[model samples]
Target: MRRTLDRLYDGALWLAAVTFALIAALVLVQILGRLADRAARAMDLPPPGITIPSLAEFGAFLFAGAVFLGLAGTLQAGGHVRVKLLVRALPEAPARWLGAVVSAAAAALAGFATWSSALQALDSLRFNSVSYGVVPIPLAIPQGVMTLGLALLAVALVDSAVTLARGGTPAYRASEARTEADTEASTGESA
Candidate 1:
């Protein structure tokens, strides 16, 4: 189960990376197209009039998808901002309890977001909603992606809570520890 969850998060992160790459690719192509058009115009040739129909809209959608898809992976990787000063200052038992409580609360919020986004997606589907761009993108598609990401994030948070409650170090906490240790080692070596 742990392995499966890890894979799921990794896959989502991979998909997010792909989306970002696609955005970059689109921009590159657009730039190239404009350069070609400009060169043609400069050479007394008809401009190809090359342009993406609704690049800005597509970019916005892809960016939103990428962000939503990255949530779980970022959390698992300890990339999310957390105020850990209090937790670190406490003894093991109290720190564990506090962490568990915080994780549970975050899980609840994630679950709510998932539910709400899913509902919105469903509603969009039912209404046959589409984006107001030259290319009519189904609004449900991006909303569904958001829902999936929120669901994964909720699962990760629940996993963290359970681990902390069982007196086990959560993946994020372990990752943070390793990062801190590495930083300290690097500083000591430099000194």
Candidate 2:
């Protein structure tokens, strides 16, 4: 089950990567189109005026998708920015409890966001809402992707909270420990 969950998280990150790649490709096409037009005009010829329809809108959607889709994986990988100074200052037991409390709060907030986003997506789907652009894309598609990402993030937060409650270090803590260990090793080697 753990392996499956990890794979799911990895897949989500991969999806985000693919979305970013698509965005880059679209932007490249748009840039090339503009350059071509400029070249034609400079040659005193009629510009082809070739442009990617809805490129801006599509790029925005893809960028949002990439960010939202990467959330769960980022959290799991301990890549999310966290203010750990206070937590590090605390005693072991207190820090553990504090971490658990923070995780629970994060889970609640993420769950609420997931539910709200899902509702918004459903509403868009019901109304057949489409984005205003040269090409009309259904708003629900991006909203659904956002909701899925939020749901995954909520699950990860909950898992971390449960692990902390059970006296197990969370993945983020483990990652930090590994980093600290490596730093110590390097320092010792230099000494």
Candidate 3:
């Protein structure tokens, strides 16, 4: 079951990357069309009537979408950066315990936060709340994507904690520091 979960997480991360690429293409088209139409108006070469998306606003929105979705993959792949100053200083035994505690707490907190925010965003969408836009997009969509990443991060965190508590982290040897990145495609034995 855990192996299946891991595969699912990896697949979702790949999906997120694809989603980001798609958004990028959409934004590119939107921006180019708007700019072209506006340019024609400025040159007085065509009818001075053109109303398209506000490139700046759309750009921000598109960027947010891409980032949130992309984050899921990154987080799942364990590409998120972590500070290891204290962990590195300690010897193996103590460091292992400390790492487990930290990982568990971090996972629980991040997961809870994301879950809560996703619910709230969903409610907002249901109620048709509009923030600074003529057309309101359902906030839940992107928020949900961000929540997915957070959930994956939570899973990774918990897995790390379990392994650390057992004796050592799976991807990390006793002496060296393994950046969370390597865990994305873990090749070692499971804890």
lDDT for model 3, please.
0.66
lDDT of each: 0.94, 0.91, 0.66
Point out the higher-scoring one by TM-score: 1 or 3. Answer: 1
- Where model 2 places Cα greater than 4 Å from the true spot, the runs are 182-191
lDDT of 1 by residue, 1-191 (tens): 88999999999999999999999999998999999999998999998877888899989999999999999999989999999899989999999999999999999999999999999999999999999999999999999988998999999999999999999989898899999999999999999
Q: Quick one: best lDDT, which candidate?
A: 1
Query: How do the residues 1-191 of candidate 3 rate in per-residue lDDT, one tens digit apiece?
Result: 56876676667656756766766776677667778778888888774443444545545655665565455346544466768899889998998898888878988897887789788778877887655655555666666666766666677677778878888544333213354335644756353
Per-residue lDDT of 1-191 in model 2, one digit per residue for the tens?
Answer: 67887898899999999999999998998898899899999999898877889988999999888999999888888889999999889998898889899999999999999999999999999999999998999999999999999998998898889888889988877887898899999999999
The residue ranges of model 3 lying beyond 4 angstroms of the native Cα positions read 38-62, 70-72, 75-78, 168-191
**Model 2 lDDT, residue 117, Cα:** 98
Whichever of 2 and 3 has more lDDT, that candidate is 2
Better of 1 and 2 by TM-score: 1
Once fitted onto the true fold, the runs of candidate 1 whose alpha carbons sit more than 4 angstroms away are none
| Top candidate by TM-score | 1
Sort all candidates by TM-score, best to worst. 1, 2, 3
Rate residue 159 of model 3 by lDDT: 71
Ranking according to lDDT, highest score first: 1, 2, 3
Q: Provide TM-scores for the models.
A: 0.97, 0.91, 0.70
